[model samples]
Target: MASSSISNAEANTNQPRETKFEKLTKRGRENQAKEVTKMEKTRWTSDAEQQNYSVKLVEALSQRSHGNSSPAAEVSHVAVRETADRLLAVAAKGRTRWSRSIVMSRLRLKLNPNKHKKQKKPKVAGDMRSKKPVAVAKKIPAVERKVRLLGRLVPGCRKLSFPNLLGEATDYIAALEMQVRAMTVLSGLLTGTESLAPQFDPLGSGRS
Candidate 1:
């Protein structure tokens, strides 16, 4: 009986020490978790800043409209638009870092950053009229400078071009509305706020 009592006391003493060691380990892990969370917050803040910069770049590029400026101004505007488009493409999602780097390289080749000052004439390369006498057209006649309203180039690509700044703003707002609608639908599914019924069930299990 004396030996059994001695053994019981030793066991009780060892168990408490083990418990204390475990508690210390758990506290260490909690501290590490806090450190990781702080680092993630910093990383997220940096990403947000980059995204905001990209958005501002897009807005700056969109300011180049036909009606607002002369053909000479349009040349400079095209340069800015092209450069901004390059940056926007870099900011595009679902692309590898290497691929984005390649795109940036190509853009750098195409966009002459030093060519910022307004040039002599418009840079677009489409013949508006069939054929013209070289000497007669040496002095480019002043044509109607009205920008095409709501210009759409292809199917499934809405708001492809806009006449002015207001139209561009409207296009962005419309895009935001679409995103909000998509988020609403997704939130409904994620939160179980809306029931999603099965349209057809071969096994007769109606639960979706």
Candidate 2:
């Protein structure tokens, strides 16, 4: 009977210690979770600071339209580069670190500091546009040259193959289009402009 009583007392004492430990661990987790992680905010500098989001986006979208068209035989990078740069500029103005596209970069990479290693870009023949333009033009295949330019157009896609680059370009273009549409609607609402809201036919009625 005495031994049983002592055993019961010991168990009661251990219970509180275990509970205290659990409470401490839970409290630590809660403290860690108190800080929320979000993308870096945009800070507008120089000319961008003066422009509103709608105007900035519209201007950026226009950059792609004004570029020189490429030969019919080859895919052109001019439009892609112009559009990506302008879209990136808008993202920068908002002080957002978009990395490459509108889709957010990985949370794992962001949480882990110094995860990205800077890679040295492979050196290529110097720009021949100013000097021996004809020779330089002949040396690099038209398709290859356009691919390189397309890679540069969309950031973080330097190594992607043509198909992948095309996919990424399409995604970037769609993202920018949506961004422009959203900004236009937002601007209209803010300025009390009776602009007609965009209409989409969710049904197949619009199709033949």
Candidate 3:
């Protein structure tokens, strides 16, 4: 019984001890899904953390652009894209909403020097076309058509039939007559064509 127990103890010592944390190994294909799940929970919860991540992302991209290239070699677009994606993935911290395309778009926007620069508003074709007399003449027919339509729609406008419209016309005529009388008097004074009215005497005679 003692000899059998010694052999069993040796067998147990040789056997690998299974532990709970051993399931979390990076190389284990079985733990990949679990690892991904755990990583998905990680995120930059604060502005400072996010800012730091952004700085690292920028540095990584810069290195990929400038430092990784050999003197004779041009950096490939695919390589640049891959580098940007890797950095962005790290910055993303397994955020589900940040897909690969979104991350790349954001990365490009952030890195581009001219992203925030305001683009000049494009000039319209009409703006470039000069407002010549010919163009003005061409537009007159349209304006006349609109005015004729308005005249047809407006009451008494077609034949000046409304009393209110007639009154308005008379008022306008009266105003023009008053302006003509004032101008005639002024011209008469200037040309010495007429004597000053008694009311126009400025030596206190007009008041008396």
TM-score of each: 0.20, 0.34, 0.21
Can you write out model 3's per-residue Cα lDDT over 27-106, one digit (the tens) per residue? 48667777865543343333344335434544555566577547556557676555544554454443322233345556
Which parts of model 3 are misplaced by more than 4 Å? 1-50, 66-69, 72-74, 95-208
Q: Summarize candidate 1's per-residue lDDT along 106-170 as a digit string, tens digits.
A: 55666976554566766567865756778766565443112222223111123333334333344
Clashes of each: 0, 4, 0
TM-score of 1: 0.20
Model 2's TM-score against the true structure: 0.34
- The 10-residue segment of model 1 with minimum total lDDT is 148-157
Candidate 2, residue 132: how far the Cα is off, in Å = 8.8
Comparing 1 and 3 on lDDT, the stronger one: 3
Query: Which of the two candidates, 1 or 2, achieves a greater TM-score against the reference?
Result: 2
Query: Model 1 residue 184 lDDT?
Result: 44
lDDT of 1: 0.45
Give the residue spans of candidate 1 off by over 4 A.
1-54, 58-81, 89-95, 98-104, 111-208
| Model 2 C-alpha lDDT per residue in residues 104-154, reported as the tens digit of each score | 433444676476666776666875344666766799988899999888877
Model 3: weakest 10-residue lDDT segment is 197-206
